[model samples]
Target: MKRQIIDTIEQYETIIIHRHVRPDPDAYGSQMGLKALLEKNYPKKRIMAAGTHDVLLSYLAEPDCVAEEDYNGALVIVTDTANTDRIDGPYFDRGAFLLKIDHHPNEDPYGDERWVNTDASSCSEMIYTLFEEGQASSGWEMSAEAARFLFAGIVGDTGRFMFQSATEKTFEVASSLIKQNFDRTQLFADMYEVDRKILHLQGYIYQNFTIDENGAAYIKLTQEILKQFNVTVAETSDLVGSLGNVKGICAWIIFVEEDDQIRVRLRSKGPVINTLAMQYKGGGHPLASGASVYSWKEADEVIGKLQELCRNY
Candidate 1:
């Protein structure tokens, strides 16, 4: 599979990288890292990273605006995305070949070639392994920037090595990147740094968070509450994790009101929440997932289902 991916890359003079919309660090990192890795090895090839911007992860490279003509004869490689509908760009199928590389469950697998591995901790980890193996077999170069980007992805998705997905192989890949002498301390600082407004919002989340008798904790952030705290929707991304450490809380969710609908981020200590997310028009890892709802009633139903999951546990 690694050889096939490399051969596909070599066959194309132009490559366009895509990921899921509403970019997270893992999405940005894997996409940017792959772009860097390909450019470092195939310096002459034209490679572009395409996606929506994420202000929370702006430290990474900005997404490129690739024209439709660029995809005419290009190879499209999508990273960290599980489904076709979530891909940010419209030119994904316009490429000569579509390659899917992800660490999510193979639900909507629609690619010419796929390297899906659910066992891998993050897509960044998979990318690191690909480059590590490719370097030994085909003499590919792994740049420091690429390493940093991959590290960010691994750390972001793994919750800084706290998530259950972080296995021994995860550490092995991380150690390989650490050997490149990237600044781990600086990366952690950049990822964790928060302004006063965000700090105040965190306080609000802590103060207003509610836990049901079933041990399902949750916080709802409406647009008015966002304005009250002077925080953007993007600023609330990291706050979901704050509810995870509370005792007796088996499942947790954060509901943020979006322009069109309600966005949900789901996390569980020991229960399958992805399946539940699927019922609500979303899916992700078993322990961590996401969903969106059309109204407050739908959001309440999701919360009710999550509460039942906690009770069953």
Candidate 2:
């Protein structure tokens, strides 16, 4: 499949890469990492990263200003996004061909050609593996800039190699990426450094979070709580994993109330949670996933269902 993707790359003169909405390190890392890799190999081809740039990701990379016309006869490759609905840009299908490269479950496969590997630690790691394939088979070269992007993605998705999803290959890829010229120290600092206000909010979460007897835990971050802490909804992403440190925790949900919908971020130490995410119109990795709920009652349904999962596990 990697070889086939390489051959497809050779056929296109313009390629646009995309990722999921509300970007994460893995999303930006894989999308922009692949962009950097392709641009280095095919200098003549117009390789672009398309999406709304998140200010938080300024440390990593910025997306290109791709106009609607740019998708004409372009090869659109979406990385790290499992479903078409989650893709950031509206022009994904406007391109001539579509390709999907992701590490999530292939539940909503939307691309003409897909290379989904659920075992991959992150889509960024998969991008490095793709680089290896192209290097041996087609003499493809990777740059230090691309290495940093992939490395950041790997670190982010694997929770700095702390999660069980991280395999031996993940460590090897991380090792190879760090060998390139980039400031690993600075990257870690940028990825981990949190504002004092956010920390205060984390403290509040620690104090107020609820855990049932079955070890199914949850925390609600309403707009009122966000206002009290002076933290934006985006900043809350950094705290999703904070509850994992609690002992006897089997699974947890962090519900962030948005304008029109409530964002559900699910994580697990054991028990498959992606299926639960799918029930609420979301899907992702087995251990980590996201979903959306429109009402507080629906949110309670998710929590109750999660309790069932933890109980069964």
Candidate 3:
């Protein structure tokens, strides 16, 4: 499959890379890292990262202005996105051929060609494997800029190697990526640093979270609380993992209220939570998943289900 993707890369003069919306580091890393790799090797070919620019991720690279006409003959490769509905940019199907490269389960598969590796830590890691294949078979070379993006993705999805997803091979990939000339220290600073307002919200969560006997915990960040802290819904994502550090916590959920609905983030040390995420309106990894609910009543229902899962586990 790697060889086939490399072959397809050689066939096109225009390529557009995309990722999931509500962008994360893994999303940007895989999409732009692949763009950097392709641009370095095939400098003549036009490669663009297509998506809305996320200001919070300005520490990384920015996306390009890919108009509709640009996709007419482009080879569209979407990375790190599980399903079609989650893909960020439009006109993904307007291209000549569509490709899906992701590390998520192939539950909602699309594209003319698909490479899904659920065992891989992140799509950025899979992109590195593709680079290895390209190096041997296609004489491809990776630039330091590409390495920075890929490394950030690996670290982000694996929680800086704290999550269970990081494997022996994940460490090996990180080792190889660091050999390229990039500022690892600065990258780490940019990836982990949170604003003062965000930190205050995290403190509030630590102080106010509700926990059950089964160690099922939850915190609700209502719009009122968000205004109180002057924090946006997007910035609240950094605090979702705060509950994992709490003692006797088996599973946790953080509900952030958006304009009309609530964003549900589910994380677990023991029981599967993606099933719970699916019961709402979202899905992701078993240990970490996300969902959306319409009201506080539905939010309570999700919490009840999570408590049941933890109790049974």
Taken over the whole model, the C-alpha lDDT of each candidate is 0.90, 0.94, 0.94
* Model 3 agreement with the true structure over 1-313: per-residue lDDT tens digits: 8998999999999999999998899999999999999999999999999998776688898999999999988999999999999999998999999999999999998999999999999999999999999999999998999999999999999989999999999999999999999999999988766445667888999999999999999999999999999777888877889999899999999999999999999999999999989988899999999999999999999999999999999
In candidate 2, list every pair of residues with a backbone clash.
none
Which ten-residue region of model 3 has the weakest summed lDDT?
A: 190-199
Span of ten consecutive residues with least summed lDDT in model 1: 190-199
Each candidate's TM vs. the true structure? 0.70, 0.69, 0.70
In model 2, what lDDT does residue 120 have?
A: 99
Alpha-carbon lDDT of model 3: 0.94
Output the lDDT of residue 155, model 2.
92
Cand. 2 TM to true fold? 0.69
lDDT of 2: 0.94
After superposition, the stretches of candidate 3 with alpha carbons farther than 4 Å from their true spots are 195-199, 205-313
Residues 1-313 of candidate 1 have per-residue lDDT tens digits of 8887888888999999999998777998899999999989999999999877777677677999999899998899999999999999888999999999999999988899999999999999999988977898899988998999999999999998999999999998888898776888988887876445678887888888899888898899999999998677887887888887787888899999989999999999998999999998999999999999999999999988998998898
